[model samples]
Target: MTNWLPSLENGTGPLYIRIADEAESAIKSGTLPHGTKLPPQRDLAYDVGVTIGTISRAYALLRERGLVTGEVGRGTYVQGNSDGRVPARDPVTINYGGTRAMVPPPGKLRFDTTAAIDVGQAETVGRIMAEIASAYPGEISSYTRTLSSDWLEAGRQWLSSGNWKPEADQVLPQLGVHAGINAVVAAVSGAGDRIVCEHLTYSQVSRSANLMGRQIALVDSDQNGILPEDFERVCAREHPKAAFIMSSGQNPTLVTLPLSRRKEIVDIARKYNVWLIEDYLYGGMIDDRIPLLAELAPDRTFLLNGLSKSVAAGVRGGWVACPPHMSQRVRVTQKMVSGGLPFLLAELSARLVLSGAAGEIRSKVLTEIGEREALVRQLFAGKEFRSHPRLPFFWLKLPEPWLSGTFKQAVLDADVLIDDEDEFKPARSARVYHHVRVGFSEGRERAISTEGLKTIRRILDQSPLGTSAIV
Candidate 1:
């Protein structure tokens, strides 16, 4: 390895990222090769005039990017090139039924593994929560005067990040996404109202509609997401009150609608005068180039964005961005059925999000996600797995002999749980891609879990289908 010291002209941002960036550039330039040993954190800190904490954090960044690996006794070694692309680790084949959680128990893991990782903004969350906890109890507990403008301004600023600016008068804060969905449904539709849905819409949306006694009109989807013409036809025939569409990185499908498709959907909604309930939960993680459905169809659209996807799902914070005409009624519904979100949670989340930690966490998450995808692709070498570049998960199509149920069972025996496609749909033989959603949300360790992937491969190879393991 080349003798190099990364110097920060200004101690701005995190010192560790600057170090990682320099090391990454060096690796890309061939100054460091595969299998080169990196200096110890203390040594690097001494060399670069940074704190040991900074060096440690820098190494963590490298680990998340799949550029290096650390063994218990052995020091860290370069795993691959600086760009973070690396071959999967050697498969440690096992007899199966022995997958263990990659994350260490509470005392060992640096980050929380038990809770669903907010992925992005975790560090920021820690800081904000710390600040909140140290404050006087009255700050968080005592009743505070309520007003709509503050929440509306917050929503407007958030929407502007995606080049959207819904009128402040149209925005309202709900307890959470579920509450917003329930309130919106209650406000828009009565019993027997029909709502158009994507064929692979989120299960919660379906359940919520059912609870409201509304009919769901399922529309077909092609590669780009829900088909435009099918949506138009469904609207024409059903004249649905509102279409609950996810135009951003959709949950199960993990598909993001391109600008052209968004235009098509918007035009159709406009022509039919149909209300649109846009679920933009997967908003902050993916590409921000494409504007949201609300931007295109603001006159008749109600947007739902919550902490559930981008932030801590359990923390329960979400806001409703409505069109001007619906703001009053939406606020009424929000108050009558469910009132404002807890000020403590809302304010904490807002502080974290607005402080730019949310965006930082998002970038970090995407970086980790890329590393996890590399491992997944390496493990499923010969299988026909598919994914979008920025998506959190992949769609794995099963082989002929591996019936979805049987394969799910096989993996379960291997101590790995996988979702069955049929459970996401009703018609068992409808031939809807018999697939499983493999998410990288399990964090870095699970993404690169040697034992877990080997078990996954064994399950794939032993299926009744005539398939052989690669390598």
Candidate 2:
């Protein structure tokens, strides 16, 4: 390397991201050639007037971007960029995974969101709100600093599954899983820390972490979900503060991590002392008796579940069951980050769950999902895709010559919206998979969903090339 010094001037965002952005510009401009080993972290930090930690995070960001690869002993080196993931803060690529949602266009079938199908739970929510209005008029007008014991008890009951019900004191309610995830991240990690995740997953947290000045570390995975060995490798290399996973019915991929796999992951997490955030939002809908991460490794795991997917999305209620004495840290972080849960919404959610209305509504929602899933079975029968009996979405691997992005655009042309494989990625990945997650839960009626699936199937049945109809 010929005296490579990244100019921190004229850059925006966090210091590390500015550094990474500068490095990216240099690489693209051929200033940093392929295989050129960059300056040592400490040396570069001294030269650039930033801390070693800043340089470390900047290097980590570069690796996540696939612009550079690091050796164990040697410094990070420049690599030729391939069309993988977009830069983490790119305005153009922020559309992935509904990070920024566009209101469904007229006549467009929205198979993009897994938001709970409205099961007339609003009626219950309205009723509960009215009761709270009448009974707790003073509480509604005031801020929610300390929630009631009823809220914790409601969370305990709502999040409990199979043999694993956390103690009421261990539970703290948040606005929803995303907010809870943000709080858990805030509580466990400092700025510039790495958050590890499977390459494809629910990406809202990935974006959320980046916005909060945390870096994302990608772990390689398979159809069965996140790999334990890769998780361990990332643990050792990235020193991630936390790992987020969906044990049952992982989003987008729809693969439930097996019991053995769950144990292996927990073991690796224990070995590395990495905090594990078990996002059970989707899992709460399933009756699988698989061991929870919280159950297996109670000390290091956080159990996150919400009313968003299983019951009413509008309620926006979520709960986090902490490990041992960890509740206070996460509880404070939740309050600080999300401005605490609204008093009215919190009470409403608690009343619904406490009164057993949420469960009844969830059952109805699942029944509707099952009906839609059956429709998917009948429509896309024998097609190559993964579907859960309870998951609101199906992961459909596109046929040869049909790239995911192109297919997504084609589906958009047909007025049906679905998520491309890229939507699930936290960052640009070296490995590419041509898959799309077709969510059926967003439809107001099965007839509307049928038309949407038919649209997707039509695109899938035809080729994109010479003999193709997608042209």
Candidate 3:
């Protein structure tokens, strides 16, 4: 280890913050290069004449900033040289009339986003919104901190389509699932607190945790979804402030947690008194038979559901069913961040649900997604990929000799876009897996999606030497 000591003289703010700032400066200046081992916490504390707790807090802050990584017995080390910024991946381009265009150039086949395909929903929503605007002209122009009674009832009715049911008063309208998740995390957890998630999960949750200054502790998961044993282990070790899980058709992996596993997770959450953030983002796409984490742990669960995945992304309407006691706190937090949900969007969403347009659109979209999934399955019959017939994405485990970045680049070179595993991984997790999430929902036409799948297969079938390496 290098004999390095951060200058604490003339420090202004908290001592721990000053320590973290100095460490960040050292890292950026190359004084503490990547992979350089940091001194033991106790030794640094003794040298700085501060308590060990202060040093520990400073290190925790650094870890959250992605400036350092810690091992069980090996201590902490600097992570990267770019001051915690993950360098952007090279854009995939295509040659067009003596010019090169990005993979997702105008009208190109896009398979990277998990957005819902249009199933005649846009016209329906537009009609409903038009009707709503005509009927409630004054309401559309005004701001509403609290959802109207009719809108609340609509939210309750929409939630009834799932396994859990909550009263309108317990539901808070959010801009979307992302906004709801950020508000809930901000309300329930604090900076430096640990948040638990599946080893392979949604990227939005990871981003929300990072933005809120929380550390993510990833738990192991199997085919049946997140393992209860691993959840218990993480809870006991990290004492996470909350656990965010997508119980149905988990993102990327598409593994739904069976009822038995849900019960075990609920039991563990109860035992540890950890809050549960149940993400039902893909719940509407699948059947409603599976048990929900919110149903199992209602007292501590925040049920997140929205119309973005089932209806159209433009809707941007969602709700967070909070515990009866915490409803007001969540509402206050949401108001503090975003004045409130857009009255017009909420009214439009409510009209869609109340008028049965949302249900009709969801059914049509699910049918289309099912057909696409069948095509994908037949196209990659023997490939090692995880998918649900109704889900929007496929988790393709890359074959040997092809790492995640390499495979992603190859697919991009062939004019297709896909998300690599690193996008979904939590910071500080030591686990590494080579996989890509191929989404079929972005392409409304089956032929376009089929073409994208064919392009991916062609790349996958190529030899390592045939594909150019990403410099």
Give candidates' CA RMSD values in order: 20.6, 11.7, 11.6
Model 3, span 148-169: residue lDDT tens: 8877777777665444578789
Q: For candidate 1, write residues 42-87 as lDDT tens digits.
A: 6777888875545765765566456777763466788874454554
TM-score per model over all chains: 0.68, 0.79, 0.77
Ranking by TM-score: 2, 3, 1
* Between candidates 1 and 2, the TM-score winner: 2
Top of the candidates by lDDT = 2
Per-residue lDDT for 1-471 in model 2, tens only?
A: 558898877855667668888888888777887778898877888998986656765775576466787764666778763543333345434333343246777888888989999767777788888988999888888887787999999999888889779999999988988999999999999999999988898888898898788999999888778888889999999999999888888888877888898899988988888999999998889868788888998899999999998788878998999999999999888878988788888788888898988889889889999998988888888788888778789999888767675567567667888887767888656456888999988856778888889889988887653221111
Task: Estimate candidate 2's alpha-carbon lDDT, on a 0 to 1 scale.
Answer: 0.82
Q: In model 2, which residue pairs have backbone atoms overlapping below 3 Å?
A: 85-428
Where does model 3 exceed 4 Å of error? 1-103, 106-108, 161-164
Clash pairs, candidate 1, are 97-414, 120-361, 121-361
Location of the lowest summed lDDT over 10 successive residues in candidate 3 = 91-100
lDDT on C-alpha atoms for all candidate structures: 0.65, 0.82, 0.78
The CA lDDT at 224 in model 1 is: 77
